[model samples]
Target: MRKKLIEAIKAAFLSEGYGFFQGFADKIQGSELTLPALWLTPIEVAGMSGRNDGKVTYKIVLYLFVQNEQYDEQQKEEKWEELERIARKGIATLPMISDVISTDKVTIKPDEFAFTSFGELSQTVTFLADVYFCNE
Candidate 1:
């Protein structure tokens, strides 16, 4: 199920011609992320419980890490907003899952967005995009 979500998210980003990004990623997917890249990982899954009548609800926590070069707090703040915008756009761009799944009750939204600096030019922003869906 996690893999399916990852593939779907990756496909959506590709279809939208998004910038450097990865799904099902543990660390940087490629060399240094080019200073402006996005990473998606399913950090956790909520307890699953529901009816056995061919439908099940699932909740997933997908962490999105966006990195950009920032020299100071002001720059970090500016880029954090941009990263938030990008993250939301990416989530909105996600295509519907397979036909077997029912998204009628599904919802996707940003749980949180944060900014931190690693070094003089290495500033990173992270956010959690919570995904809720139903599948058989």
Candidate 2:
């Protein structure tokens, strides 16, 4: 069920014309992914009050890591435009990926860029969604 949600996210972004980006559900190794890539995985699932088939709804935090190449500030405004576009599209794409069950609002927060173990500059955009997918 969680796996379906992950795939749905990638599918949504691709169908939304973000096919240029790569999506991952596990820890990426090396620098396998090119710039503007994304890593998505379930972090936690907490039970809530809503019931589904006698199961409790859940609040899930899906981690999204956006990897990118070094940004050259001696660049054009469109470069900035493009980055913002990616962020916006990423945020908009996940909410529509409620595969296992209906999902509530999705909240996304893109953190500052950090160097990954692979030495690539990446940003973490944590997406929050509430659904009815209990791990059981």
Candidate 3:
């Protein structure tokens, strides 16, 4: 079931002309990811009962990375604008996932390391997806 949800997310991002990865940035070894990428994987899964059908909640964090290439003042503004646009689109796309019963409001935080080492600006968006699975 988790794999099904992951594939659905990949397909949705692909349809939007974006690629979705299934793990964290630190986990990648030698592969170079294209800038403006999205990454997510289930960080936690909990089972709950006492409701209609038992529901499992998947705690997911979605990350978006944008290349912070050198740019003029005007271009800097454009870069920030592009980041905001992509983040908004990602938020809107979450609840549309199949079997997603609810999603909590999220806060997208900027990664501070962008100014130090990585020349790419990234944002982390976190939310929980509750899914009801019927007993077989």
Candidate 4:
């Protein structure tokens, strides 16, 4: 189930012509991030109920980076909007996974101070993927 979710996310971002990575190191260095990238962090997994047939949910946070060559506020906001659209499109597929039963809405927050030194704008997108499975 985790693998499915991860693949879906990668496809979603990759379809939009951006790079996808699985950690914080590249995102923080700014210099390391290839502009127009999504950094994925699988935060936690928790069983939704005690019953064996119950659902299990996982939390994921995606860090989106887009280049802002001149550090223009208008361009930054536009990039944020674009990233939000891509995030929503990705979240919409959670229910399509065979084991996935539901998903929370995508929550996006702009990091105004993030990676400014490298002329990049960043945003954080968070969502929950809930699935019903006997074993993960």
* Candidate 3 segments whose C-alpha is farther than 4 A from its true place: 50-52, 71-81, 115-118
TM-score versus the correct structure, for each prediction: 0.49, 0.53, 0.74, 0.81
For candidate 2, what's the RMSD?
5.3
> Residue-wise lDDT of candidate 4 within 60-100, one digit each (tens)?
88888887767467877787888788777777765663456
RMSD of each: 6.4, 5.3, 3.2, 2.7
- For lDDT, the strongest prediction is 4
Candidate 1 per-residue lDDT, tens place, 1-136, comes to 5566666666655554444454354454333543333455443444444444333334433433444454367866665565566555655554354322432223333323332233222223233233444555
Superposed on all Cα atoms, model 4 deviates from the true structure by an RMSD in Å of 2.7
* Candidate 4 lDDT score relative to the true structure: 0.74
lDDT of 1 at 100: 20
Error of 1 at 1 (Å): 3.3
Query: Candidate 2, residues 45-112: lDDT per residue as tens digits?
Result: 65555344333334444333343445564432344455456655655655565534444444544434
Please, what is the whole-model Cα lDDT of each candidate in the order they appear? 0.44, 0.48, 0.65, 0.74
**Top candidate, metric TM-score:** 4
> Where is the poorest 10-residue window by lDDT in model 4?
23-32
